[model samples]
Target chain A: MENPPVTDFATDWDHTDPAWVHDPYPIWDDLRQRCPVAHTDRYGGAWFPATHAGVSAVAQDTEHFTSRTVVLGNGRPLEDAPPAPIGVAPPITSDPPFHTIARRLILPAFAPGPVRALEPRVRELCRRLLDDLGDATEFDAATQYAQFIPPGVIVRMLGFPEADEDMFRDFIHVVLEGVNHPVEERIEEFAPIEAYITAQIEDHRAHPRDDLTSYLLGVEVGGQPLAPEHVFGTIILVLIAGIDTTWSAIGSALWHLASHPDDLARLREDPDLMPIAIEEFLRFYAPVTMARLVKRDVEFLGCPMREDDWVLLGFPAANRDPAVFPDADRFVIDRLENRHLAFGLGIHRCAGSNLARMEMRVALEEFLARYPHVELTDPEAVTWSQGQVRGPRRLPVRVASA
Target chain B: MKVTIDAARCQGHGRCFNLAPDVFGFDELGNGVVLVASPPDDRAERLARLAQVNCPEHAIDIEE
Candidate 1:
């Protein structure tokens, strides 16, 4: 274990800060111009790669930056020590050859086939959720509509009891928001979630079903059954990975729609433009920004990063990079030649990208048809989470029931 | 237009299939599988280009 290199970092930034979460672009814009490879001693000293090229390189270079502790400033024992170290999972924390197997097991669920198969269900869910909002002209889109779809889809996929959704949501919040808690407290909070998942795994063992847990139980890696620890971790990963990530994305997109009626109407008029629009929304309001712990000493984009140091890949910043994307700040729904990194690049790209897109598309289309005149009740009041996933925590949209 | 996919580089983000379903298909493992269904018209040609450009891996190529 080598000591982290101490150096005076140029910028002082913290993701846990609400101001940063509400609007990080201005600060990121400043970083890209002044300090593309900036550093901070806040979280035991971590680097911030603000530029597109810099973040892309950091995310792709698996040899140097490892996905051990993705959460920034994830130190352990409720103290200043770096949090639990390549986490015992196969895909997210595991690198290269090992990641391939774990990713493959979950790939089919998100592939075009399964996603397409779930389309009708998605539409129905959207309609029912909208129905639940009947005669209500004023509502928070975040809770009323956007937040429900992702977790609902996951529950159906995992065969978890729908009644347990509130509990699951609570667990996910604690786990994902654990950055604010001490490592021990975080673990204590997460113990029930782990126990619940364990019971599900054991139940599936006794009565195997077609759900993800049952399937994962039988999955073999390199002809040997994947370890129980890894399976449990993967399930937890799926819960956290699936729920808020997509909801944040969908919330942001709807927020954009509320603010920009022209774009919303255009999408309604030309539904064919949706595929392109979805991509554009993802690029502009990209939700996830994950970090990787440096595995060994390596210099990235001329900045020397040492082992165990955190380097946050600001993927959303990369999408706004003018060098790669012309008119990067503006949201062009039908923008051609748009290759955005809303989902992180390389092997660790979002495992649920397809499902996310499908959910967003269904929600957007159905809402447009039912409530065509959706607009933000108070644009200034919209707030986003200041964490790995970004989305409107409270989005009040005014819609005239038609 | 003829298109090619560099199998080695493809991490299977599946944008190709999502954008241009006619041009690309998915293998069992969810990697994009180039289809024999060629771009037969201008609309398809446009989609093929969109798919190629949006590929996160830059795995697709056009040979018109």
Candidate 2:
């Protein structure tokens, strides 16, 4: 869906706008300076908090905002969707009280210990991907390398077919990037995803395996099997949330390195710098800006918000807030005092953060090790994905050696 | 100095454990726990302070 170019983002902001999609940092920076909280009548009336304080306040405030529908669309979410506290995606879409219960059930799976156990597998996947490029001098890094890493790992985790990776990418695009489509169109677009998830759940039931999908089906809360919706929601959440977000992170970090040779050289010189560089990459190119539906009409950050209003929680923007970080706009490779809200803040913080970080670190380490002398073939040719998750969709780079 | 993590504020970000492995470790749920409640030396103290400052949730507290 092509949104009309945004003239004055303060009053009429559209995240899907071409200008914002290509590069939103400037738009967010402009909004931060002019109006800390920008309101727009689009998306059935929504508010955008540009400043770190405003974003942090709304992210931490459950009373005023509802997580029922984190993804904003033209249609009112509650019209046909489930009520607050238990939305389509549990934990992420579930509000507090209930949010904790749902979160705890799956937290252990993504806990540092469990996530660390997958490092070797993730590193192997990265190596395989790099090896596949095999003596290629020029290749698309985003699609060829970065994009394949997360789907490979997630498919293995979910016990899904390796062939379904392409389909997963399509489903993510429909759910995330196709926000501006009409409600009817949106429902039609979502039909395949719904059908696919249902079929996967049924299959998992028939053939139990040591995978996350089976675990979710078997796990109980309060000594009772999880509700069908709970199991389904959590499975869908893991698949959708885990894939594109990390893929984007890996892609963006590579894109940055391809563009900035000095940073790449420094990373090559200091192997220990990978961990710090990864954090800096997350802070600078942080993808994934979540949305929240206002519970009731209330004045927040001095803005008069109405019931069911969409709050485009911009964590990516918050990461770039100058008041929060010194030289916020500049990417510091060895940034020490960094507390960027890339995974977000509060209870709804990303559950797959550990896995995401591990994938990113391994992806970069392997990529640079394989193709140390890499640069953009055509910087202008690179394309960034639109909507909440941002990253290079097509990165054309020339590698000097294998 | 005494180091601690406010369990209420710590959402298991793992920053403490990642930054200062000696002073902090993660629980089963991955939330940070003070391994050495009182930093034994200046090195541990520096690491604890580093974790405190880098914690996005501000969950770490050091009483000097």
Candidate 3:
């Protein structure tokens, strides 16, 4: 099999660069061609698997690559220490055997029944959030509409206080976007969120209900109850994964439709295209970049990967790989063979994926249903999130009926 | 029509069960457990086909 030329890049790039943050596709395209498996000193030593094949290899080969330290390079996860980091979210930060158990413990919450059962409430929440906008012509789609809907679903699902949606947004922002800040500051920002998760776990232990937290507490993994830290970690993981991930996708879909009137008209004129459009949106504006820590040194696919190396599974980049996707850049709504890795491939594939896609479909369906003709008010003012999961942070649009 | 689910490939995205619950069952972990190994009825054929198509992993296979 022919492969893209691998250019040895000792100093590849950083995620925080403005050039990368504003637009990463050009950079990703460049990497996919020149350095399919590139390395950098960024984050103390990280590897970039920028192709569909490269990413799949890393994500699928958990035996060689571990999830022990996913984000921080060459260090044990915070969950490893005593007091063991409040709400130490698992599955993502764990290796096999254990990750498998954690994954099974939480699967039912996001299964088809739960997600389908939640759809009516999701639709009602979307309707109410849209209703509050009340025909405003110019509004920040991110804050005004996109941000509110997911948190409502999350808040309702997690049994958190209904009014604390903004709190969810703020905490996630710091954790996902505040990579520029020192680890200490980021931990300080995350402390309360973990505490909140811990409190919820405690509450569920005493006042167990039908909620996810209570469910986790009641389940026995490996013939033993899950640790409080694991429970806390899982809840926090669910909250972080649930709330903002799809919010950005929904916001980007709006950005797409608002900018492209023909597509909007097509979707509006024929509602049958909504499902296809949702997948297309996920493929085109694919969000999320996850990482795995190298377990041992192995020359992988012509690249020398060392032990303790951090290899980022470029999920979004893999989605746009030209070798795998024809017209990798174009937004073809009806594309049938869309085997995209917008959700990371392999065992660690997104547990929240079903939920994210469901939310995106419903959000867009109700959105264009309410306001058919929409346009970007200030396209220049549009901004996207910087680190971890990437999407529109601020998208201003003018709706005909709002 | 015959429908087979490769457990090795099925990562439990639940797309199969989501689209056609009648044709697929779920283990406690939400992994796809095909109820009807091979379709004897036309309704099961359609349902299995839909489930196969929706699977993110393409873990489900249909044979005629």
**By summed lDDT, which 10 consecutive residues of candidate 2 chain A come out lowest?**
A77-86
Q: How close is candidate 1 to the true structure, as a TM-score?
A: 0.93
Q: What RMSD does each model have against the real structure? A: 3.8, 1.2, 4.5
On residues B1-64, what C-alpha lDDT tens digit does candidate 3 reach at each position? 7678898888876667755667888776667898878767878788688777656577898888
Off by over 4 Å in 3: A1-10, A72-87, B14-28, B33-58
lDDT of 2 by residue, A46-149 (tens): 99999889999999899999888888888874556654556788989898899999999898889899888999998898899888888789999989999889
Evaluation by lDDT, superior candidate among 2 and 3: 2
Query: TM-score-based ranking, best first?
Result: 2, 1, 3
Of 1 and 3, the candidate ranking higher by DockQ: 1
Question: List-wise, what DockQ does each model earn?
Answer: 0.73, 0.80, 0.40
lDDT of 3 by residue, A185-287 (tens): 6667778877777777777778988777777788886688878678777777887778778888898899999999989989988897787687778888887
Indicate which candidate wins on DockQ.
2
lDDT of 1 by residue, A180-271 (tens): 66556777887788788889888988998988888888888679876787777778778888998898999999999999989988997899
TM-score of every candidate relative to the true structure: 0.93, 0.98, 0.90
How many angstroms is residue A179 displaced in model 1 relative to the true structure, after the best TM-score fit?
1.1
Model 3 steric clash pairs: A87-A232, A87-A233, A88-A233, A89-A233
Positional deviation of residue A90's Cα in model 2 after best superposition, in angstroms = 0.5
Better model by lDDT, 1 or 3?
1
